[model samples]
Target: MDPILDDHLHLDPVKGRGVEAAEEFADHGGTHLLVLNKPSWHYDVAVEAGDDFRVAYDHTLDVVADSTEVLPGRAWPVLGVHPALVSQLVERGYDPEDARDLMCAGLDVAAEYVEEGRALALKSGRPHYDVSEAVWAASNEVMRHAFALGADLGCAVQLHAEGSEDFTEVADWAEEAGMARERVVKHYSTGGVVGPTPSVLADKDELERVVERDVPFMMETDFIDDPDRPGAVLGPKTVPRRTRWLREEGYDEALERAHVETPRLVYGIDTLGTLA
Candidate 1:
């Protein structure tokens, strides 16, 4: 089989981290790495690594535009308003009605602020979506308007869903927008407080559902490492642990086979280096 692609990673040496981790990854033959733009300080390490690097940008175009100028190739930023921050906007005493109007006003001001403040982090980065609430609140007309802007920008929208409702809602929204599944990359982690943990690594029945749907989603292991606290991710240590889960769940061999036999089997990883 070919070398494995680690989808997510970090590298920031100035802080006495990232550098060593990145070097270790290089030595370990990790080819492609997904580096988020959030920690702008880490851009150096990712840039120095060259074309093997890809940036996961947030929603703003200016942020991504600046980064693209700085680092020519390998930039993919997903576009969408952050669902998590929606509640925060309300908490800040911004009238809900007014805030909704501001958001609907073309994401111009928000995009500008995001670019100026955290350009490296937001551009070519992922903006998360709250699947359940988005569906529950948005009218079909509102949903179409939002998706039109996102799709026109040529960025994938990363989704976070808790239950079957979340999952189905997203799929329905994509259909409504007339966007291909390939344009939407769903982020599936372990079962949340309310939903069933996705069987990305186990449960053939669940995995089959993903395949059957022809969804344009990728498998990303969202793990955070803490020296003082181990097993924070609820799995074993090292990449091998993830690989083992994939194998045990009949994913590894199958994915490799698909890569060889079938045409396109899209996948991604979250956080590769900089565990500091």
Candidate 2:
């Protein structure tokens, strides 16, 4: 089996399948994962300050440890303030500026985890939907803060923003923050997005289209592991399942790039590394 990896996933021991979901992915041939924290609200955290994010980040780290215990270092954690948290903070009574500041503070906490080696990446981005201009501006500010943290830590920043083929501004921000543009990955990528390196969704058609490019890319299930939604975003097994189909279709070289090579380059971790 190849070193299949899901670039973005979330586990909720409280509200989702959590570690059990890791078993499913492993059963289907997935060898590793880049597991990110769900939104702050998902953990019942109301952000009054950056420290509020720790409640969620700690849980995510715990989940990572537990999943790794089962999969033997197959899981690494990415901690951050989700883009939607800005609005959630606002709706929950935070002034816009306060909400933005709190989000930045949240990223600071996440960066500490990365510096301490408890996590490998920081996640941040503007909301993907329409919003008031002020809110949008604030979200961008928080994202910039995340890039700065990534630069300081020399770690990757996983971005979750509106879907687009281009991310020129995001590249500019990453460069300004002293983070390599390639280190900024676009989560939920549409197979062939431009600018940041893509973590393309593990769709058969999408993977097939991007594999031929032979660029730095990885495939992901983006599995939320929410029992309520069952397979929201994508399921735990999707990446491995799609990878198997791709292999049978004779994409060995490209699959190696996606499965092993790209992950090593982008995350500074070898394919399943010592994890497997």
Candidate 3:
């Protein structure tokens, strides 16, 4: 069976279905997942400083551990500070510069986890929504911090930013920071990304187009596993189900390139191979 990897996913055992969600993914033919840490607020962690981000990051690793107990090395944690946090700190009386410092510290903590091999990638991006110029500038600096960390650790950095397809500024930041362009992934990508690798959202039309491209790319559901949203971005089984659908539509070669070749090139995971 071809390895159906969901490049981005989230699971919560307390407020949402956790390991059971991973089982649902496995049930639908999914093989691996990059389980991302939910934003700080999700875990109600107080972000006074960088180390405070560890509360949420630690929770994410715990969730990955629980999932891996069953999946057995099929799941890995991706840790980082969410960019929207800058605004939240501002609203709560934190100076914008302080907020940026705090966010950078958070990424520092995340890099420590990556160095410890507790995570496979680092996650960071500016707010996907709009903010003031100061906040925006600060957030951009925080993004550079992540790119710099990616360069140092030689790990992937998942970005959750606001953009259609062209991430020219992001690309420039990564290049200036010395991070490999391919290791910078844009989560929830639609298609036609120019610089960073688009972990294309698991949508049929999007995949149909992206899979044909010669560029290295990936697929992700970005499932937050929030019961309240009940499939806000996409359902948990979207990736594997989409894979099966694409296969039936005679996209075997495309599947090989996207599912096996690109993942191998980006993540260095060897379990996935050419489509048989």
User: Can you give the TM-score per candidate against the true fold?
Assistant: 0.50, 0.96, 0.95
Clashing pairs in 3: none
lDDT of 1 by residue, 188-268 (tens): 432221111122422334445554543332333332223433333322123333444455776655445322222122222
Residues 1-276, model 3: lDDT tens digits: 768888998898768888888888877888778899888788887789788888888888888888766652378889998888888899999989999999999999999999998888899998888788999899989999999999899888989999678997788889888877888999989877878989999888888778767678888998988989888678888998989898999988877777777777776775453222
Clashes of each: 20, 0, 0
Candidate 3 has its poorest 10 consecutive residues by lDDT at 267-276
Could you give the candidate ranking by TM-score, starting with the highest?
Answer: 2, 3, 1
- Could you give the candidate ranking by lDDT, starting with the highest? 2, 3, 1
Model 3 spans with C-alpha error above 4 angstroms: 273-276
- Candidate 1 Cα deviation (angstroms), residue 233: 4.3
lDDT, each prediction: 0.34, 0.86, 0.84
Q: Write down the RMSD of all candidates, one decimal each.
A: 10.0, 1.3, 2.1
Q: Which should have the higher TM-score, number 2 or number 3?
A: 2
Q: Which ten residues in a row have the lowest lDDT in candidate 2?
A: 267-276
Query: Roughly what TM-score does model 1 have, to 2 decimal places?
Result: 0.50
